[model samples]
Target: MRTPAAALTGVVALAFADASIVALALPAIYGRFDTTIVGVSWVLTGYAVAVAVAAVTLIAVRRWLPTGPLTMGGLALFAAGSTWCGVAGSLGGLLAGRVVQGIGAAALLSGALELLSAHVGRERGRRLWSGAATAGLAVGPALGGALTEAFDWRVIFIAQVPVALLALVVLALSRAPALEPESGEPTTNPLWATAGYVSLFAGLVGALFLGVLLLVEIWRFSPLAAACVMMALPAGTIAAGRLTATAAPAVRVVGGTLALCAGLVGLALLPSASLAWAAAALFLCGAGSGVVARVLSPAAVPTSAPLVRSGGAVVAAKHAGLVLGLVVIAPLLAGSLTSGAEQAVVTGTGVLLDARMPVQEKLSLALSVRDTFAEAPRGAVPDLAAAVDTTNRSEATTAVVKEVDHRLSAVLTRAFRPAFLAAAALALLTVLAAFAVRKTPIGYPRWRAAPTAILAVLVLAGPALVAAEVAGGALDHGRYQETDPCAAPADPYPGDGVDALVQRVAYGALHGAACELGLSRERFLLALAGQPGFAGVEWDPSTVERTVRAAADRALDDVQQRGDLPGWTITLVRAAVRSMPLEELLRVVGLR
Candidate 1:
């Protein structure tokens, strides 16, 4: 009996988790369908809109639905929806299935609320229901990411079928909850409370939706890595569960909203692409979301009204917020990414032109980079590594490749700033919306806020200070400022690894070459990229080519004058100087 009860509970949790499970899958879906961010976002928006509509419609029919039959029926529908989604051949087909899934989700939530209340007491049942929903929301993205990384995005839908079926079987065999006639008005979903929900859920889109996109798409992290990084969000939420358990409901709502805003702001103005930094920001978001949801869910359910109808109102309000957030976020993100793509190309070009390699190599790199970005799908991190393949390159070229890749990643991070800020602005509105809950349910169970509330606020604020530089960035044009590569001297010979040895050998020759060219090592390196033909200045291939030939002639003369430089190193430099379609020159400086 307990096992059957547990299975039913798990089913309820699964239904709620389905709401945002696809966040991690969006990139895969977007790439697979070759759709725009706005287009793929419908994948989430469809579910939210359908669920909101279902929850609202279910409220009208709540009276006649029997708990046992409803639960079983909902599970069956859910299973069918999962099957449909799993087999979908097109985006439209996936959306059709999501609608079915949403309807099934509402039915299950309603049935589970009544059944659990009958099994336990009403208060415990409601608590269990709310807790499961938030837990599911918290865990959904990470779980989806793991599954997507391990398998295909389709598997997330396919996997749900068996769980739903098993729960349906257990439910069919279990004792039914007795439904009694209730005497009360069908509660009007409170306007103020609904508005608050709208704001809270809308704000959450920043943490759950945009946060994942930034991690996977912009940061170029694997879905699994992004999932692990985002665990901070759920962890914060779960931690806040106990921390805010006893605080005043109003404080939890308002304070939680503020924390979410701070986290979003941090995300918008991220200090770096480091996973640890992003996790710190998400932690505040998770904690705040958890605190608010727990307090808001039960508080929204009126005691005098039927539980299912009242619960439906809460679901409707929450999903309504999601739908609203998506509607706005989708378009804004699409435009931001579009503009960022251009900036990325410009930034990438500038980095290559300024590289410490041969002018001829710079010319070649420009072409490779242009082709790579052109071939890449919209919103993808173009594989810059491919643009500068180092498999067989000279050690000097390989070091340059690493620097180029790292520099591009840093520049790309800025491209996502505008979208993240938009999300933060949405979250900031939650503070105002939270105040609409003028009266929290009296005597309702609280997650004891205790001293943790103070600590949570302080922790959330910590990221804001670190991220203060975002304001400066937003005010400036997307033109990234890179330091003078020549300003810094080379490091000590790196570790004893193979790549390290290669760099050591390469730098030794580079130092010799710089001296041969009668220039500082940095100036020698910077000269090629600074050529007018390669730089943003008007093209002057004649002068740039002459400059390269002159540098090569001077280098050879100096080596002969010194009689100490390696002949092979000069041979490599001479080949690069003439590389532009004396195609045979490539063999001289070929990869090891």
Candidate 2:
């Protein structure tokens, strides 16, 4: 009985882990497929959608299905889908494979519990299944990161095939008693459970999805480093589970919801990229989630229904919550990022124009900085210091560069704060849902009821204040001093004919090449000039100008031979260089 139970539990763990294992790898996947963050999210969303649909459908027809065959079939399908995901060439193909994988996951998860219940008692079976699922969630990010770093993101999915197969073989040979039909109506309300699941899981998006992205893209942590930091969440969950085991269901639900709210609010108020602060907040979130899971999981699938149906409902509600969280949070994140970038640009320009350098030198530096901003990858904060030479320069140049870097970093930090606030709103909603739990009324005196009522009011008021702040945009100030600094500049090379044509060709080709290489124009130029054979090459303003002319000449020749470039390529070039500094034209035409 123990061996079969372990095997089935292993299957459950794998299925649960698959739901979030790819989160840390999202940026890598985005770069690989050359797609938008929203588009890459479908990789996660598609799997979740499939799981919700299949779990609900399976629940409606579990009576006609045999547990052994269903479990085996699901395992087999999972293996095939994993193979497809590994080999898929496009984003669409990967998403389709994920859907297939989700379907198999639904069957395996629902059937595994049913098999365990038949072999052991229902109480013991539920404990083992829940433990295994939590363990999987705990280890998923670390495992996914190790796999991705050791090989590639594709390996994370591909490596699961053998594990699923092993589970399949064990289930194929194990014997279990038939599942008895459940009696009586459900004691717990499924609607309330579903609502709670949505709120709780949605609240978790900041810690799991967006948090991972910020670590990798903004904080510049390696995947392995980010995974290590993320372990704080699961660690807290495990500890909280042990401590809350003897608590009443109502106590666990209400306390956990409040803890979650506190954690998200802490995250929103983060001052900087301090790992200690992040870890502490994540620990709170994990502990809260663990406690909430204790009350909510069983409630979602009442014992009155068939075990399979109950399990299916639970699975569907949980994954559906993940989908809901992403849908609401992704757009808010995008909007904040755009607003941040615009603010950064304005602030950076003000710093540049105020520098005490000659107009020509400042203009050259401005053009370089603008190009860097234009070519920065989505969700990445551009490093303005690298684009402009600050060291071994005039005092005024260094001061101005440092100020611009500081302002840009500040803007980026402010942008992500809103996402945390949005997540906090979700956590607050979870707290409200906790009120629906059926608690046994205590026979306390009327005086005690007044204190209890006051505590409840205080709890509700916290979230209300947070929501009011978010709606009122209270935090959106103090970053911008000037809206535009480079509105007009004296042209150093104002002319037409061949010089203009060459400048246009150079800018267009640079933009096109940067797109293809998945790097900013400044980074690409630095890389090109830093090749091994060119180790000792001088990189003064003249040398860089020469390199640009040569690259542009090559591009023009290629375009002339090819006859035309893509329409989008032309559009991208125009947009990129529309606000180019005056020195860029002079540099291109060798006019100093």
Candidate 3:
């Protein structure tokens, strides 16, 4: 006899997989939609929001509805959404389809979890789904990356249709017993409960959004490397999930929530700290998020009629968190930059919030000082000398330059810290909300929601956080270069194919470029080589020389095309300068 139990597991796994599949498709989505940084996030936010609502409302939705029809209906909606997304010509249409898909995802997600919880013993079920969801979560990104690399992004959704249909066939073939629906009003009314879940979700999502953006944008990280670091969230969640049964339920929920808050605080406050410390904090926060998801699972369920409603609520709460993370946090972080501006404005309206400003800039004189510094390099004189002329002060430009640089640094630091502190406060608030996740009854059947929720929190958050940074230009759009090894070779020369030769010629050029541009060549190269196309490609002389020259050319064309330095990446500029010269550098950097 075909069993219903394994089918439920497959369904939940698929749901978890779908949630992550979008992460790798983000760059492609942006290419088609051409949406702004904040706007593009809604593609994710829309899906999450719809899913969150569906999870909470599905209990009532499925009350009169049979599982067969319910599953089919959801699958149909999902298929329709997938089709819409696949062929969407505009951002709006894509977003709408994403929302539809999210709704379908929520239905499938919660429905499958409910069925599994009812059919299997709770603890065993929780462990099984927990492991399955975690596996799916982990696999989603890798799958998405591979699919995105191998085929058009539309194929991802199109491919899902068969899976959904297969799931339906399994359901039709199985003779699963229908559980009696819980009859009575829920402890938490559906509407208010959903709102609360949405609110909490928003805070968590916001914390992630702000944390990651600050890490990469303000701090600067490469996309692939940032993604690697963000994996700490899933790692933390897994660790927390493992500890949940061991710890007192109340303690796990409360402590996890508190950790979640602390993570946000660390993310906001500890940007300048070592990457390990920051990642650790993110892991803790993710663990707390997992704890919160697990804790809420039982409450969102009832051991009676309308069972699906409870399961739906749990899923809704989980996805709501995701929606809030992306949509709310991104704008808040962007707004924080304005907060710095507001502070400057409060000091005096004359000050501007120029993202293009050099790292050194006082509120009062940042522009003039930055101008002086830039001009200094052009004049072959000390920046301080140039500052005098720009400031029109009697003191030597060098002296004024030092004073300005010092003052500018102080102002920028002050302005930036407040935003970080604010982000920390929001994280702390999220931690508090996590505590609101009620502890499960002692020996209560382990809810599938717990682990699935935790997995979602960890894995989904990792990609979202990374995406937030990429969209914000924190990590440069996958660009890098090497230094020239030859003694001022007039032409970019070829090199031998030995590892040391490649290192000496190409890596050396990268290092030189980094030094000249005052950037970390090692870090930048490390970042670039980390991308999918470049990963493990190796540092060969021919490859390095070609790549270095290409990168330099790309950098100059980038500057000219975009009318600005690409991510202010000096290494790319230097590589271009070494490969060609001032005119070529300008032409390449300015390539439109």
Candidate 4:
């Protein structure tokens, strides 16, 4: 009995570990596949969705499948899926492999629990299962990080193959009993259990998903460093386990939910990318999750039902929550990040245009800075200093650029706060759901009344906190106003020809228009270079600047000759010079 229990525990640990082991590796996967965050999120989502679907199906047919064969078959499938994931060449292929892994994981989870219940009774089995899963959750991120850093993300999955095989061997040698259905009415309510499970996982999405992204993408930590930081979550869980072991289910649920909510709120209010702040938040999350699991697991699936069915239901609910959380949060996060980047570019460009420098030098500096911003990887904060040409720039100019860099970094950091707030909102919902868990019969009404009042306070307090922060200007939503560079006093030029006028306007208007359009100068130029009649045009800095000046010259010449050109003619010319290549502008003016 002991040997079989130990073996099954190992299998359970692996299955749970796989759920989050890949989180720290997500950025690496995104880079490797050249995929969007939403696309890359499908890696985690696909696995979770597969697990939920398969677990449900397995539960429906629990009475027909024998525990021994089910466990062995799951191990085989898990091994195969791991192999496929390790060798997958594309995002689509990797997603397919993850689904296979999810299916196998569901089977193993349900079957192992069923076998344990048959061998040692439901009470002992639940304790062992929870402990094993907690152990896996604790180690997954760190192990995944070490493997991803030392080798590659693929190794994380590949390493799972041997562990699955060993579990299979152990199961075979133990001769575990077949699953059997229970006869009595279930003590726990399935609806309450499902709700609790879903809310628990949904709240965790912020810590596991957004936290990892912030560490790896925005903060620019190596995968190993991110993993090391994430270890706080599991460590908290382990510490809370002993403390919550004898607590009433209701007390544990509420306490855990409160801790998780506090953690998420802390993340939302993060002043900077300080590891100390993140660690404190993650510890709360981990500890809360541990307590929730300890109190909620047995209740999640009624002991009156077949052990396999009950276990399947619980697993399905939890993974489904993960899928749901990602689906909702990923889009919000992506949109916030896009808006933040645009804001940064606009703000940074304004700083450059207003800087005290020679016009020609400013133009050169702007081009260099734009190029630097363009070179930064997606979802990463641009390094402003790296974008400047220090060799030719004055100390004053460099100092200005450094200030712009600081502002850009601040904007980027502020962007992710909304996502964290959204996560905190989700955690608050978990707290509400946890209040629905059945209380002990001894003080049922009195216990329920106090928590009900507390739940209301939490519900109101969460949004209030978010609102206060936003109202305090933690999230800036100001729009960029396009400046009219051609307005008012005209600059005195040595030459009165069309070329000189065009040069003045082009230099004056380009930065303002680009800011209005939320584009870096480099991006705006490259876009123009790609327009009609500009095919095969060289995009070197000098070439792009010359082309813009020439295009402005042609547009001005055309409007002047027409004499009756509308008041908006100059506006059209400016737009053309900003968007169209010089050749395209000449063709539009009938001068090609």
Candidate 5:
């Protein structure tokens, strides 16, 4: 790479990084700007929307302008936008800055390509730009998280000012490169390639956007800690570059899509609030997305079409998908999480009431939790230091507090399940598009559509299974309104005896099941215990059928009511619940 191309590459990385760099900083901005997740999201989408519109619309504009002048001007405007964002007093003002930066970024991206092509070969220039952009997307959030932790979120924009200026300085000092004339009538876009970009970026929302929020808001990790965990993304992305180099295009797309889907599924079903689990899942996402981006991006740009117009298609498709993901997924995520948060607190109330603590301590602790939640920012799990604050520390009180917080985190993690799965499904669409550009595995040239059909089903199955469990969106405002026993218990008790813990979980599950059934816990337990073969050595399917219906009817009812679906629509639900190996579960619930 020549000095000018290298300089432009640096800025291209920064500009694309600018797209997602604000992601980790959003939680801080959330409270600071008094915005919800939906509102704060415009900070991200605004830039992307601007970039998408400008990247395409400016194609005609770029045709007339000299690359040298255009790129220098773009660097200056980018600096101006950064300074504006740094100093903005309101979210609206900051958004305006984002728009400015986005337009400038479009110019930068366009001009960078021209300069690179002039200095390096056309093919090499496109490769460098694509790699830098992909790397930028992967690196942005982690770097933003680090910056936000070290200083204020506003400092992030201030920090970019120097980078853009340094790039401008390099370009100024280097030799001016000549712009290449548009050689082909690149009138039309590659449909499959564009679709691939759309699906790929839309799915990435699960990994980059929601993943960071889970770490900072729900897990109560600091921005720096979240950044450290997110480092797995870039590591895996870089690693996948090497791993997929020899793989065929179709294999890269299908395999990458599968990996991406699996990672998201892993996220949806995360076992605990362990950073290791998150990092592992994100690694899969990173590698998968990296493979997809590298293969699909060049495929979108046709060999015959003008590189600028085709580049515009790729840019427009990607950022538009981001905008699309934010528009669709953000609302879904916000709605589900809001109600889920309230439900979590209501569910935790059961643990509080069930603990062996005295009434006075329970009341005191309840009040403290209520106050903390009432004061917490939207979409954030409150720090509950004072939740167990008392003149004297009682073991039962302390235990209950720990369990409730644990439950909150667990439920919050579950709240994101739908969004993650949605993202995975969206990414899966790219595999269908990838088939349009499929090159068989190196040694498997005769592989036909049968394998493609099977791959499609395999890719589609996971999200379909998870989506079957979809209930309605969460309650309004996610506020902990009152005592409710509806959440399912899944976490192991920390430092708890197995027998004692199992007994507690059994009762908790029974209690929640009974609440759904509109029966008292005692009543539900007695009903199961009275059934024939209750606690029997022989598992009786006949009596089990009776017992299963007794317990499952209420659950199916709730599912129907919540989803506004009719009884017959849930035949699968009936089959699944009817087939559950609930003998053990019922026995545990039946324990005295």
Candidate 6:
């Protein structure tokens, strides 16, 4: 009896330990897989979905099966899944393994709880499981992080196998009485409840997770800084968890869920991407999540009997929420942002390229185009260029910045609006789920609640306080901003004099309609020749083109010698010339 009880408790702890443990490992997983925010999130999603599915199914089927055999079978499945995850060659395989492990987790968690509830009185069962589970949850994140940082991420999963096998051994040796099923009105279908929770949570929490990640990644927040912005969630969860356990379980569950919905909607509608706004949403959602977990865990368990099924349903609901959150919400946000950015860039660039504009306007537009690229960092330019050509340096820089900012704002609006609205809807659904919760007696003793409250408060306040301090010193680190080691300001040397002289002749010819303007051998030839020509016919266009290019090259060389400017200026001029037709150069030169 002692062996079985001890083994079950250990198994339950192990199952839940992984949940929080992986939170800190998100960066490591992303690094190894070359995964983006959306893709990497599946590490949690896969596991959760699998657990949800198994939790409900295991509970529903437990009546027809032997309890010990079922528990052992679940453990074996979990072991296999863990092994597969550790050895997985690809991201897909690892995700699959996580799903498999989730199924086992669902069974193990449910079975263990039912066993505890059945062996202990309903009141004692709640107190014991809640106390143990809370402790495990608190320890998981720090322990997992320390281990991963010290050794390797693979060890995190691998470490679970031995402990599980040991639990299986204890279960096999113990002679425990069968956990009786609760006797009352017809039981609510575990599947229906699990599905509802999964859908609702996936839509709400998943969106928040993906949305915040993009804000951090694109906007250039450090991982720690980004995590700070996100800290509101866990804080809320801990605080609410402590407060609501003393209240009616149903009230906490239903009301907390509604709060979650409101929070999600709030996030979606937030006009600015400020950290405070994001944190507020996170706090509301986190509070709701914490409340729901506290409420649901107790409500799902049967006070009378069939502890296994009830426990399973609870675990299932939790994990299902995770799986749905990952698959559904992530893609919606990522796709919307990507599509919006692309469309805005294309439209803005096309408007500037219209042929009917005056020559000076066209020239101004070109300059703006180069400026766009110049203002944006090199890393961002490539993505921006996909919509507009960075082919022109001076004007492209500014144009890209305008286009990028517009696109980002548009996408953020498009994606978040729907996402927030959906969160509101999901919160409403949670309120509806609260109705499904049967009236069970509040189970924990008064003493347990106090400690739970204290711990919860500490957990909730720790990060929030630390983050407030850290954010005080934090730099904005926003998008399209320059970082360290910026390129030195442009230095035009004596060659710049050449470039100026050439420009003078070219402009003079255009302004005065001078044909065959004389080039200054050293200065004018050095500066102006390498540029692209305008569109039209040419009298001896090819000779003029060649002459201009040679002159530009010489000017760039002179600049390099006199002002310490690299030949990159000359190279750029050459590149521009290559793009222009010789006929266009002649036309600009007033030859035809």
Order by lDDT, highest first: 5, 4, 2, 1, 6, 3
* Model 6 stretches with alpha carbons more than 4 Å out: 1-10, 13-31, 34-42, 56-64, 126-152, 169-196, 211-232, 248-251, 265-280, 340-421, 437-582, 585-592
Candidate 6's displacement at residue 368, Å, is 17
Tell me model 4's lDDT, rounded to 2 decimals: 0.72
Tell me the whole-model lDDT of each prediction, alpha carbons only: 0.70, 0.70, 0.52, 0.72, 0.72, 0.56
RMSD of each: 8.9, 13.1, 18.3, 8.2, 13.9, 12.5
Off by over 4 Å in 1: 179-191, 392-396, 432-440, 445-449, 452-592
Task: Give the alpha carbon lDDT tens digit for every residue of 306-338 in model 3.
Answer: 445555665666575566556545565445455
What are the models' TM-scores? 0.76, 0.72, 0.55, 0.75, 0.75, 0.59
Write one digit per residue (lDDT tens) for candidate 4, span 164-240: 89888888887655555556665556667667777678778778888888888877788899988999988888877
TM-score of model 3 vs. true structure: 0.55
Candidate 6 versus the native: TM-score? 0.59
User: Candidate 5: which stretches are off by over 4 Å?
Assistant: 179-189, 302-304, 377-379, 385-387, 439-592
**Global local distance difference test of model 1:** 0.70
Among all windows of 10 consecutive residues in model 5, the one with the lowest summed lDDT is 469-478
Residue 175 C-alpha lDDT in model 3: 60
